[model samples]
Structure formats: C-alpha cells, structure tokens
Target: MMDENDVKELISSYKNIKDRVEIISNKFDRHNVKLVAVSKTKPTEMIRILYDKGHRHFGENYIQELVSKSEELSELNEIKWHFIGSIQSNKSKILTSVKNLYVVETVENKKILDKLAKSLLNNEENNNNNNNNNNKKLNIMIQVNTSGEESKSGCKPEECLDLVKHCLEDNNCKNSLNFLGLMTIGNPNATPDQPDFKCLVDCKNNISKQLNIPLDSIELSMGMSHDFEPAIEFGSTSVRVGSAIFGERDYSNKK
Candidate 1:
C-alpha cells in the first residue's frame, strides 16, 4: 500500500542516511563500504520502491520474510539481498535457495556452514539439471561474538580464526560458498573505540596473518544504524542499517 508519497519519502530518508554513511566512510578512506539497508519487517512495496530508485543492497533479519521478499522481487535482476539474521540449521536449505541472495552475514558454526554449503551445492545441481549454467556461489561471513554477549548469536572471538579457516579451506564450501569476511552485532552501549568493533578487527587481522590471506580481501561487517560511523572508522567494510532509513519497525505483525 505504499504510494508515490511513501516511495518518495523512503527514498529521501534513505539518501540522507546513505550520504552520511558515505561521508564517514570516505573520511576514513573506506570508499568501498557497503550499506545494506535492513528491510526486516518492511513490506515488499517498500523494498520495490527502493529497488526502483537504484538501491541494490538490502538486508533482512528473518529468513521467512527474506525468502518472501526475494521471491516477490525476483524480477529485479540486479537486486542483492543480504541475510543478516541468525540462521537455524533446518532452514539452511530454504535460505540458500533464495533468488538474488548476495550474502549470509551471520554464519556462526561449522554445522550451520556445512548445511548451508550442502544446500547451495544441491541448488547448483538442480540448476544444472534445469540447464541453468549461471549458478553463482553464495557468499558467507563468519559471525563473531566480540562482546561475549550471551544473548548475541555468534562464535566467541577466540574461536573465530578457526571458523574462518574452515570456511576458506573446507572442500564443499570451497566449491559452493565464497568466504566473504566477518560480521558482528556489537554491544549497544559501547563507545566509539568499541571493544566489540576492535575485537572484530583483531579477528580479521589474525585470520589474515595466520591464514596467509590478504587483509584487504577480508571485509568486516560490524555496524548498524546507531554505530556505523565508528564501525566504519574501525575498518568496517559493510554496515547494516535499518530504522534510520525505513523508520522503526512494527514487530507486532512480524513474520
């Protein structure tokens, strides 16, 4: 039910925040920092409006909603959907099969990663059988619990390096998934020199050094609407921002 007025308003709000994000990123020489507009509880109409306006990267925190939105927006060929939610093991198949899903940014364990990779490999086989040769590998980021928050969903900081190694070296993952980088939902009240953010940076550094991977090749997805600027300042290559652009979510009717 989003009309022209709603569309225009959404675009306006999106541009305002996007501009600020870019300014901060550029100030830190992070010119390639990506803004994944979190569209979790928002409608497909809202997503369509932004897609029509040339916004390609959108994120969702719920798997069902993400799959529904991707299906609805499949006609938009260039749209990129980032799954920023906590993935359930049983739902990996459904998540991997989403059309135009660019990346899953919350991969926490080998079990989930293996499930996702297997599902993606199956998708490849299905596409091959259907004569569709454009089966692209899915991108995945290792989620790190930098703040050691019990409520947060991610692997502990000490365990992140091994996970990254597994994602990079696992045979099935090598063929079916692209190890994109690291993602984290930092502690809310932390300051600019946020410990959570710094821990992610350290994790990336250790991975790069120990795994003999280049630092530049490994990206960091560590910011949300509230702390993206500082996250960017601490070398975040991607930020997931909601609310600031689409306004606060009404979770009463959440999917």
Candidate 2:
C-alpha cells in the first residue's frame, strides 16, 4: 500500500493537473469539464487517500478488479465509480451492482445496452418492491472509434448517431440508460492537432445539435495520460486518465 507521503505526492500531482485544467477551462470559458482520476490498477489504500482528499470521481478499466475494490471499501458513498473498459455481457450484472457507479464508458453495441437496461430496470423494480435497496440510474457513454484503431472497442464514428437513436428508442433501454455523453480513445501517437480528437469533438457537437439536446450535459470523454490537457482545452467534459496518476503501468506483470 502507498504510505501517507506517497499519497500526498499523488494529491499534489492531482492538484497540478486540476490547476492546468482550470487554466484550459478559463481559456475556453467553459468550466463544466470534470477530471476523473483513473485509478484502475492502484491499491485500495491509495484510493482511500484520494477519497479522503475530496476526489469523488474515479475510473476503473477492469470488472473483477473494480468489484474487488468495491467490496473492500463498501462504506464509501461519495465515490463515483466509472467502468472505462471493454464491458463484456457476462459481467454486466456485477458491474451494474457496484454502488454509486456514475458512468460506463464503453457501450458500443445494442445487445450490451439491452442487457444493461434490463439489469437496471430489474434492479430498480426489485428495490421498489422491498427485495433490494439499490436503485440508481446508470449513466452511459457511447464509445466512438475516432482513431480507427482496429484493436479498440468502440463503434465507428458514422454508426454513433444511429446507435444513440437506437438506445433512445428502445423501451427497455431508454428509461434505464441515461445517455450521459460520448467517449473516444485517440490514437496513441497522435498530437493535439491530429484529426482524431478534433473529429470526436465535432461529432459530439453535431450529435448534440441534431438531437436537440443540451450541449452542457452532453459529455465528450476523450484523452488519457498522454494528451489530456489538450483534450480539456478542446472541450472534453470528462477525461480518463490512468498512467498519469498511477505512474507507468506494467502490463506484463498483471495476472
């Protein structure tokens, strides 16, 4: 576990990042963007420290690991859990059951959306009938394949509007799934001027306009450890940062 000093260093880093975000926000005159600390592989003790420091929003990229952490810290109500990985259908139930799950960042298909909608509705109904106590609308963000990465898990940009329409039209999904915004992972090597991120922001704007929705509430989730500052500058309501906060990641060391 990370000690107090280590936690302090992490908090300092977060403050620096937040200060940077504020500068970007002021430059653009938009203060609505949010910084979601990506705490995917960090230890629970580190997460507790972050929670204690008033960092309420955190993101995770794996189902099993997130569930394990949730169990270990089941009493924390102020934390918002965001599942930002490729969500499988089999794990939907457990993913939806986590308390205070603020958002899911990788819904690309209607099948998964249907499954999630049913889960949320059933959970709500069960809670209302006194069989359960958890009843909260699970927010969703449609993942868009802005970089055209073959290995990524998002719908192509052209298919996004139709999928959003489907999600809004489906009875089982409409009431349960709150279409919070759009998310994209830029090409790892791309710079701020790269067309990928710009294209995502454009798509987000067009969708919000065409759908006649409030632009402020429609999030544009993009950027990561590498290019999040520019992402915030270009109007990303939510940024999924991982390695920046947790330092470098060693994928080979994972089980």
Candidate 3:
C-alpha cells in the first residue's frame, strides 16, 4: 500500500481535480458531474490507499486486473467500480461477476450485451431464490466512435440510434442492461480547445433528441488523463482519469 504521505499527495491531486471540476461546472452550469479516478495498472495496495483517502469510485481498463483488484478489496462496500475499457464477448461473465460493479463504459456490440443481460438475469434469479444482496443490475454505456478511428471500438454516431432502439426493444435485454449513457475516447491528434470533444456532446444531444430519451439519464462518459478539463467543460457527466491520479505508469513491468 502507498505510504500515508503518498496517499495524502493523491488526495491533494484529487482535490485539485475537483477544484477544476468546479471551474468547469461554473462554465457549463452542471453541478452533478462525477470524477471517476482511473486506477487501472496501479497495484491493489495503492488502490486501498486511495480508497481510504475518500475516493469511492474508480475506473479500470483491463478485466482480469480489475477482477483481481475487486476480489482483493472485497471488504470495501462504498467503492463503485467502473469498467472503462473495451470488453470482449468471452469476458462478459467475469466482468459481470465483479462485486459492486456499477458501470461498464465500452459496450458496442449485441453479443456482449446479450451475455451481460443473461448473466445479470441469472444473478437476479439466484439472488431472488437465496435472498442474496450481492446481485445487482449492471449499468452500461454505449461507446460512440466520435473520432472515427478504425482501431476504436464504438458504434458510429449515425448507428447509435438503431442500436439503442434495438437494446431498448429487446425484452430480455432491456431491463437487465440499463443504458446509462454514451462513452468515447478522444483522438490523439485532437486539441483540447477544438471540436473533438464537442463532437461527442453534439452526438449525445442529437441521439437523445432523435430517440426521445431523457438527456439527463444519458451520461456522457468521455475524457481521460490528458483532457478531462475540456471534457468537463463540454458537459461530460463522468470523466475517466488514470495516470494523472496514479502518477506515471510503467507498462513494461507487470507483477
């Protein structure tokens, strides 16, 4: 675990970020924006330290790593886990099994959605029979390819309406997979002051209007370690931050 001093530094960093959130909130007039500290690649010990320091929500990119961390920190009830990475269909069960997992941000296909819906339904049924409190519906955010990158995994802006319609219409899938909002990653070449992030905001507005869905219910999950300020300014409800909170990451070394 991080030393008390390091934990204090981390908390200080978060406070700075929160202050930035306040500035952004004033510009946008939205005060409900939540900062999801991205803790992916950090050790469980560091996670524990941050948890103790008042950060209850975290975002993870890898399924295996997140599952391991979740198991290690099972004692902490207030931690709200968010899976902000691309998810494969084969890993849906593992993702769904995470205790107190509140959000999955990279949902683009029906196969993965079906797996999650089925798993949630099964868990709900099991919970009903055994009166288990552990079972809960998994919230999902449909990813949008605002950058139009070939490598990114998100539904196209034009295609999102159809997908949302299909997801809402499917009886087995609708209730189990709660569509909380939309998520997107910024293009590497895009500037923070430019329209790159605005595209996502525009997309959210158009989709919400087209579908006649409540805009408030649809969260815009964008931004990251580098450009979260601009993201917040663009009216993002939740921002996923990683290296900024955890310091520099050495991807070559993994324990």
Best by TM-score: 1
Which 10 residues in a row give candidate 1 its minimum summed lDDT? 1-10
What do the candidate models score in CA lDDT, each in turn? 0.90, 0.83, 0.82
C-alpha RMSD of candidate 3: 2.0
| Local lDDT at 109 for model 3 | 75
Q: Model 3, 14-126: lDDT tens per residue? A: 77887887788888887788889888778877778778878788988889888988999999999999998888888887888898898998888777778888878877888
Ranking according to lDDT, highest score first? 1, 2, 3
* C-alpha lDDT of candidate 1 relative to the true structure: 0.90
lDDT of 1 by residue, 1-255 (tens): 877787788999999988999899779888788989999998888888888888899999999998888888889999999999889999999998888889999999999889998998888899899998988888999999888878999999889888877787899988888989999998899966799999999999898989999999999998898998999999999999999999989999777
Q: What does candidate 2's lDDT look like per residue over 15-131, in tens digits?
A: 877787778788888676778888877778878887888888898888888898888888998888888998889889888988778899899988889989988887788788987
**Whole-model alpha-carbon lDDT for candidate 3:** 0.82
Which pairs, if any, clash in model 3?
Answer: none
- Considering every candidate listed, which one attains the maximal lDDT? 1
Q: For every model shown, what is its TM-score relative to the native structure? A: 0.96, 0.93, 0.92
Cα deviation of 114 in candidate 1 (Å)?
A: 0.7
